[model samples]
Target: MIERLPARAFAAGVVTLALVSGVVSYLMVQPDPAVDTTRVTAAPAEVAASASAPSLVTAAGLEQFRRDYRDRFGDTLLDEATLHDEYASIERAVPHSPDRVMPYSYRGTFESDHSPTTRPVGTPEFDLDALDVPLLARYLAGAPQSVGVPDGSVSHVGLGIDVGEATVSIYVSNRAQENGYLVLTPDGRVLAVRRFEP
Candidate 1:
């Protein structure tokens, strides 16, 4: 009995430690401020149907985004007027989500409309005046080193935002075909875009 009591006490201590650790880890993971809570509502008393992404970005909206994305950005780098128009289109179509964004990918392919891919793998850290998208903008504005481009490349072309049935897509291209992926809020702030090859 004495031996069993010791074992039981040790097990209880381990269990308590594990529970506390899990809670601490969860709390430490700061909640993203871009998650949309506006869609949350009490289920109507009449019908029973609730199964979809909390935020419903429409097909038409995505289409508009695609259209806006048509013009390649990096070529001349969108002039202020063009950027304003692009922003206006986005503003009209997609209302900003009140919730925090949890990092989304603005993925697409970039070919012509841009310089040849020269940077093979590693290019020394430097700044590029890429596109006007939040991610690219943030890059040029703050973290230029965190960008993907071929050697000698200075900017990326901006393709409009495209929303597929499942994904919202924003395409940009530079010397590096796959320049980077962006984490954007509905309000159009680029949380971050990490440049990589692949």
Candidate 2:
């Protein structure tokens, strides 16, 4: 012989369990008010919007972005020249730290005065000190030709700094159409050739 609960008692117990689960789920989904949440753009292509932003260098926003970066990752040294491009030099920032286990990247036209957002990418792989603004400029000067873009075509370069590697995208286009881009290393090595179908 076994003892069983009445139907009404069983129904009440199920209802209480369901109510508790619902409340727990709701609490878990709510964001903590103490944390600062910034929007992270997943793709490097999304950074193209920075091109149209103001060209002025706002040190305040840039500094705040750096501070935010430090708060999140505890990174004290940032290498800014890594993101330099001849055309859009003022619209980029690259914050790097060797102490971090995972590599992180920030998105925004940081120099143009917008708030910076970050997302952890993957494991570290790049040599942090390999390139500077002058070196990057030299590579950009020759990137269009190496990628087979026309001699007089205009180009926009954006740098994506992964934890262990640096991916430089050189977007080229003529007066008529989009011509895709070239993926290059910080040292001018051609890593990939991307083609756009129009």
Candidate 3:
């Protein structure tokens, strides 16, 4: 008779074959079908829809807003003389015309001669009508000026005006600490205005 293997050896050989077969079968199979790719798309339209609409404040309106804001907030925290000086500086920085007509509807003329050097702490209300438009526009366009809160102070003053249909913003440096101004139209319409202390 031929020689036979031991029972334990035969059983071990069978188990090894079964394990190899299982691994091979697993490797041959395809990936699962759960993944979905239909949701991807360009997001620009969605982003645009979510953004806030632009404001429609005009140059004239901006001036009025500044006046109202000054009248409302000036005395609580601004030196009158300092405010006038700041305005003078702004006037010097911008181009002026004798006719006082700004190129842009939102711009206004700035006058240094009439600027006030000292305002009573709580005397006259802040006047938007007094703001020089050309100077104000130039300032908003990033022209440098010394105005708002002083060097050591943390509070700074600013102006917000609406001209035609666009709202313009102006910031005064803490070092200058002067008064702020704005111009607005007659309709009393406003879009937006923001202020910060620096």
Clashing pairs in 2: 124-163, 124-164, 125-164, 126-164
lDDT on C-alpha atoms for all candidate structures: 0.24, 0.35, 0.24
Model 2 misplacement above 4 A: 1-118, 121-129, 132-135, 151-154, 162-164, 195-198
Per-residue C-alpha lDDT of model 3 across residues 173-196, encoded as one tens digit per residue: 344454332212112211222222
Worst 10 residues of 2 by lDDT: 6-15
Q: Is candidate 1 or candidate 3 better by TM-score?
A: 1
Candidate that would win on TM-score: 2
Per-residue accuracy of model 2 over 1-198 as CA lDDT, tens digit each: 111111110000001111223222100111134422211111111112244331111222223334544565455333222222222232122446333322233344223344444534443333323434334443344444433445424244544443344654556566666575554555644444444444
Best-performing candidate as measured by lDDT: 2
> Considering TM-score, which of the candidate structures 1 and 2 is the better prediction for this target?
2
TM-score leaderboard ranking? 2, 1, 3
Error of 2 at 113 (Å): 5.5
TM-score of each: 0.22, 0.37, 0.20
Candidate 2: deviation at residue 29, Å? Answer: 50
- Write the residue-wise lDDT of candidate 1 on 29-75 in tens digits: 11234431111011111111222211112222223334434543322
